[model samples]
Target: MYLQHPDDPEKGEVSESDSIIRTYQTYNKPYELQPEDIISLRIASLTPAEFDFVKQYEEQLGIIRKLNQYNQGTQDGGNQNNMRMQGMGAVGEEGSGLMPIMLDRQQTGFTIDRKGNLELPEIGEVQLSGLSIREAEELIKSKLINYFETPVVRIQLLSFHFTVLGEVNNEGRYTSFDPETNVIDAITLAENLTDFADRSRLKVVRFSGSEAQVYYVNTLREDLVSQKGFYLQPNDLIVVPALRARQSRRYLLPATTNIIGVTASALSLILIILNQTQ
Candidate 1:
C-alpha cells in the first residue's frame, strides 16, 4: 500500500496518505438541537395514505437536487448520508402491508424557533432544544404511539450546514447530513483545496456561547490527526488562505505565460528572416 516517487524509486512519502484520521474532543457528544434549527419529522401509520407527504417530499427533493447538479455543471460533492439513528428500518410490507415512513419533502423542514420549539403541522409545538437527534426521535415516536398502533418515526436535521471559504475550487455553504464531519470531509465537500491553498494555514472558526474560538492546523504535518481542529463542529467556518509567498504566482502565472509566448514568437520570426537573407 505504497507508491514510490517515479523519479526516485527509493523515495516514498505520499503513500502514507492512504488513510485519513482525525480526533475530536467532543467526539462522544452528539449534536444537540439549537434554536433556529430545522428538522424534518415523519411518522408511519397503518392508514395507507397516512403521512404520505414524507415520501413525496423525499421524491421532490431528489428532483430538485438533480436539477441543481445539472445546472451547476460539477459533480463533486460530499455524500449525503442517511442518518437513521433509530425508528423504522426498511420499506417492507412484512405482515401489515405498510411501507416504512420517513420525513422529507422538497427539502422543507420545521424550523425550531428562538424558543427552541418546533410548531409541527401534525404534532403541534414540541420543545426540542438541547436534545440530540436520537433523543428527539424517541420523544416524537413516543408521542405518535397515541395515534398510530406500531408507529414509526424518522427525523433529519435539514439545517445542519457549514461554510468553506477561500483557496478552494468551490467556496460556499454546504449541508452536512451527517454530524461526524472532519477537516478532510469539509475540504472534500468544497471540491478540495486549490493549487494555491496554504496547507499550513487551515483556519477553523467555532462559535461558542458569546465567543468565537479559532483553531489553526497544518495539513502537511503528521500530528494534525491529534489536533483539536481536526474535527469540524456543526456550523464551523473553514477559511483556507492562499500560500502567503506564492499567492502572487496566481496573478503572475498568466503574465509569465504571455512573456514566454512572445519570446518564442520573436525567436521564430528571427530564424525565418535569417534563412531568407542567406
Candidate 2:
C-alpha cells in the first residue's frame, strides 16, 4: 500500500520537522494501482515557463516528430501491417505461418537506458534508446530474420512507467499499457490532479541521452492543449506545484501586523494630544 505523508500537504513541501505525523501509515493504502491515483499526474498542471521548457527540449530531442510519425504511421506503409490478420489465416501472406511469432519490442518488459538502447538476451546490446516501440520492433525483426525460420517477431511497450512528484493525491511512479498510453492517459491513470495542485506550475522532466531536460505544461489555461499532441515516451517525469494559499497567507501575515501597529500608534498620539491639552 502507498501511503502519503500528511505533512506533505502543509508546508508546500515535506519538511524534516514533520516526521512525527504518521497518520497515513494507519490506513494501509491499497497495494494495487487505483484509477483515482492518475488524476494527480504532473502534466495536468503546467506553468507557462515550464511549457516553454517542454517545447524547447522536445524541439531538440526529436520527440515531437517521432511522436507524430508514430501516431500517423509512416507514408512508407508501416501502418498497413496486417500481421495479426495474416497470422489468423484471414489472408495468406508470405511467412504467414511465422507471423504468429510475438516479437513486439515494446511488448518486452524492458526500459531503454540513457543511450536509447536495450539489452536483449541473444541479440546482446540492441540500440533502442530513442526509437519508439514500433521502430525498435522493426530493427529487431530485421536482424532476427537471419537466425529463425521466417522469424515472427512483435515488439511492445511492456513498461511504460513515469514518475510524478509534488502536489498530487498519489505523488509517485505510474506505469502504462502499450499503444493506448499518452500524457493525459497517464495523468488520468494517476487519478487526476488535486484542486490544490497549481495548474500553472506543472513540469515534465525527462532524460534525453545522458542529459535531463525539463518541459513545462500548463493546466491553468487551454491555449496549448491542441499543440501538446499525444503519447508520452518512457522515462518521462511530471511535477505539479502546490496551490497559492501558502504564498497568499505569507503576504497577509505581515500586512496584518503592520495594520495593528499603525492603529496602536494612532491611539497613542490621540492620548498624548489629550494630555497636552489638559
Candidate 3:
C-alpha cells in the first residue's frame, strides 16, 4: 500500500522560491515491433515521376479512413444502445454486450509473420524483428532507394491493444493509436476500476521474448507517475484484484448464513417431535 505525504495547514504558506521539490525522470522509450504485430506501411515518392504511385497510395489511405469513420459511428451507436439497456436494468454484466460490436468495428492491418518479417508492396520480406518504427522506416527507405529517388517511408503500428482483467467495470481488450498511453488510459478504456478494486495491488504483466515480467503498481501514490511501468505497451495486461472485504461479502457471508439457517431449521424440527411425544 502507498501513502500520500501529509500536508500541514499551518506550514502551507511557503513561498515558491523557498519550497524544494524532487523530480524523477520518466522513460519515454519507443516500442519495438514484434511478431503478430499489425502495422501500416506507406512509401511516398519525392520525385514527380512517381506521383502516380503516391496518388494511388493516398487514395487507398482515404478509403481506409472512410471505413474507420463508418466503424466508429457504428460502435458509438452500439454503446448508446447498451447504455440505455443498462439504465433499464436489461443488461446484467458490465461488458457483456459490447464485444461483438467492438469486433465488428476492428480495422484490418498487415500482421508481422512468425519469422519476424513483413512483406510489403514492392519490398517483400524485410526483417523487422527487433527494430523500432523509425529504424524499420529507414530500412524500407534504403531498400527502395535504387528504384525511386529518396522514397519517403512512413510506418505506424495499427494494432495497439492492451487487456484489462479483474475488478474493472468493463474488463476486456481495448485498442488505440496513442503511443503515450498509460495505465490510467488503459483502465479508462475498460470503464475505470470498480468499487471493489484493490488499487494498491494493481499488476501489469508484460512479455519480452520468451519471458513474461510482472510489475506491481500502487495507484494510490503520486510517485507512480514517474515509474517506467506507468506507461503501458502494446499487449500489456492490467489486472486489478478485488478487495478482501468485497470477496467476503460476495461469497463467504452468504455461505455462512445458509449453514446457520439449515442448522436452526433442523433444531426446530427435533424440538417439535419431542413436544408431540410428551
Q: State which candidate has the highest TM-score.
A: 3
Per-residue C-alpha lDDT of model 2 across residues 1-278, encoded as one tens digit per residue: 12222334655664568455532112211122211111110111223434433224423434444444444543443343311222344355445342232223232234455555554445566675445445655676676554443543455454556887876677778766555555556666677777667766577776655788776765543432432323355567888777788556668878999999999999999999999999
Please give the CA lDDT of all the candidate structures. Answer: 0.71, 0.51, 0.75
The TM-scores, one per candidate, come to 0.59, 0.43, 0.70
Over the stretch 22-85, how does candidate 1's per-residue lDDT look in tens digits? Answer: 4334333577899998777777778465455445654566566545534343344322342112
Q: The CA-based lDDT of model 1 is what?
A: 0.71
| Per-residue accuracy of model 3 over 14-122 as CA lDDT, tens digit each | 5567565656677768888888887776666856654545345545655675456546656665445212222222456455443232222223456689988987555
TM-score of 3: 0.70
- Of models 2 and 3, which has the larger lDDT? 3
Angstrom error of the Cα, residue 68, model 2: value is: 41
Ranking of candidates on lDDT, top first:
3, 1, 2
Q: What is the lDDT, from 0 to 100, of the residue 172 in candidate 1?
A: 92
Query: After superposing candidate 3, which stretches have Cα over 4 Å from the reference?
Result: 1-22, 43-108, 144-152
Go through the candidates in order and give the clash count of each.
1, 40, 0
Query: Model 2 — TM-score against the truth?
Result: 0.43
